[model samples]
Target chain A: MLKATVYVTLRESVLDPQGHAIQGALHSLGFDEVKGVRIGKYLEVNVDTTDKAQAEERVREMCEKLLANTVIEDYRFEILEG
Target chain B: MRVAVIQFPGSNADVDMYQAVEDIMGAPVDYVWHSHNDLSAYDIILLPGGFSYGDYLRCGAVARFSPVMEQVIKAAEEGKLILGVCNGFQILTEAGLLPGALLRNASLKFLCKLSELRVVNNSTAFTQDYSQDEVIQIPIAHGEGNYFCDEETLAKLQANNQIVFCYENENPNGSINGIAGIINERGNVLGMMPHPERAVHAWMTSDDGKRMFTSILKTWREKNGVTTNA
Candidate 1:
């Protein structure tokens, strides 16, 4: 089986208000050195396929179709043997 | 006019949409389940607000894949009028029926209050009843009502006059250009953060939203060449 880990984040052009709020909270907590904070999503999927190439292809399709809204977000995934 | 208010699991505003069409506009309306595959019979399709599929993953992410959405897409291609409010707007964006995506409000709060919106384009089927630049009151209730789009899409929208409504007075959710509502290029699909259904009656704060329903019915009647309501 192949375990795919996907990370989705707002595109650089899109504003991240939630991330900005987090940055403010961190600043209040005295994390002065933190210049920025952008929030995102992480997902782990276990693919039953043994073929690494097929697993990668399917996982990419999944991210494009359902896991990510590519209009405002960008997504990348890593596959690992499980 | 025949209207279909799509009801996905977790949709809380379906009844409001039904009542707005049936009671206010005196139109025949029905609740269509998310699993239903056909929408060709309906003249208008209303996707109302709510946490569809618990808003899991992202707002409307899972619900966009519902069986009925395929039919909705087909209906859009056929130039059928579609109005998506709040979470319905989110679903339309996720389904790629509309451009841009809604993000969490800049305040990071679930805002539920009346908002002032200016009618930007009164030529579309959705806003024909309102005069250009007319400010109207509508209630918005959502945490993810912020709208975002790339510069190219924004330019196209402006050039095509697809922007139907803009937030008046103060911007509520930090949407680009204070965009409160927009119509598709074909002018058949409209998605907005505000709830017109909830504001259909005079007793519901302001009845400014009633004109939106009337606009749809008027456009449909004109297109179908029906002078009187049957």
Candidate 2:
């Protein structure tokens, strides 16, 4: 089995209010070094296949179609073997 | 006039839409489940406001894949009038039936109030009853009502006069150009963030929404060469 870990984040141009609010909270907690934060989504999908190449392709398609909205966000994924 | 109000799992406004069309407009309307994929029987297709599928995986992403959406897309392409309100607007954007996507409100809070909207374009089938630049009041309830699109798309929308609604003075959700609603290139599909369905009755809200529904009926009437009883 191949496990795909996907990370989706808002594009840099877009402002993330949730992330900004969290950053404010972090600063209030005295984490001054953390100057910025952007919230994102993480997802994992396991493919029942032994071919790494095909698994990667499928993962990309999943990310483009459902996992990430390319219009406002960017996504990256890495595969792990069972 | 026969209309179809699509109901997804988390849809809470289908009943309101039904009442707006059936009780107020005195038209025949039916509820179509999200899992059903046929819309040929209806003249107007309405995607009402609600948090469909619990708003999972983005506002309207999951609901965009509902079985009924395929048929809705086909209907949109066939030049049938499609109206989407609030979450319905998000679904239309996600389904690629409309340009641009709704983003999180700049305030990051659920906004529920009466927002003054200007009729930017009155030439479309949905806004035919209203005069250009007329200001009207409509209720909006949403968390992600801010609209976004690329610069090119925005220019195209402006050039084509597809923008239908804009915030009056103050931009509530920080949408680009204060856009509250827009129509497709063919003027058949309209997606807006405000809840026009809730404004059909004067005892409830204002009756501004009535004209929007009438606009659709009039357009249909004209297309089919049907004369009104009056």
Candidate 3:
């Protein structure tokens, strides 16, 4: 078995409204100088494969197929031993 | 002009969008349930706006896991024209099909009103009918429509002309650079907060929205080189 962690984040050029809202809230609350903010998602998956290469392939497939969108988001995966 | 509108639970605008594309635009349109995975029959796949999955966890957070998205993503990669509007835009972002994320309104209020949007780029297959800097009126309804991105990425997008639409006159949600809509790198997928379907005809409001769908139809015809839409 293999454990994989996937990190997904919007591309640098894409806007992040959630982070902006948080910044606005901070400013409204008197926390000035909060330069910037951004948000992203993290996901972990467990694959029932022993071969590291196979598991890695599966993880990448998962990201491309569902876990991540190659268009506007970038995702990276890290594998863990069973 | 066969269009497929994917319907998810809690999607209120699915029927409206379907009618606009099918009945109003006079194209053959069908509603594909979110569970369906096959998209080979349709020329266009539209993810219409609405609060999908009740905007649980986050707007479009849960709906990103829908089964149909798998097929949509594949078809999009194959150069199919895919449009996501409003909540649809949020879902596209969450699914990673589009860039950026939709956060709460700058004022944290649910805003529903007609907005003026300027066409920033008319080079995409979806915006071929528009001219550069064309201003359009459409309705936007959502609590989260503010767009954000890093400075470097913003510059890249500007350089590449990926931004399709920017708010005019009023920046409703405080989007970065007043971005209201954007297209992907391949120019096949488009996501925007404004609802063109909501303003396709004069009776509905204005025909500015009709031009977008018409433009897509024109693009498909131009690419196929066959003008047979009977």
The candidate scoring highest on lDDT is 1
> Fraction of native Cα contacts kept in each candidate?
1.00, 0.69, 0.12
Candidate 2 runs further than 4 Å off: none
Residue range B189-223, candidate 1, lDDT tens digits: 99999999999888999999999998998899899
- lDDT string, candidate 3, B187-227, tens digits: 99999999998988898777788888878888888888977
Recovered native contacts in candidate 1, as a fraction?
A: 1.00
Better of 2 and 3 by TM-score: 2
- The DockQ-based CAPRI class assigned to model 2 is high
lDDT rank, highest first? 1, 2, 3
Q: Model 2 Cα displacement at B157 (Å)?
A: 0.9
Model 3, C-alpha of B64: deviation from truth (Å): 1.2
TM-score of each: 0.98, 0.98, 0.76
Q: After superposition, how far is residue B228 of candidate 3 from its true place, in Å?
A: 6.3
Tell me the lDDT of candidate 1.
Answer: 0.93
lDDT of each: 0.93, 0.92, 0.85
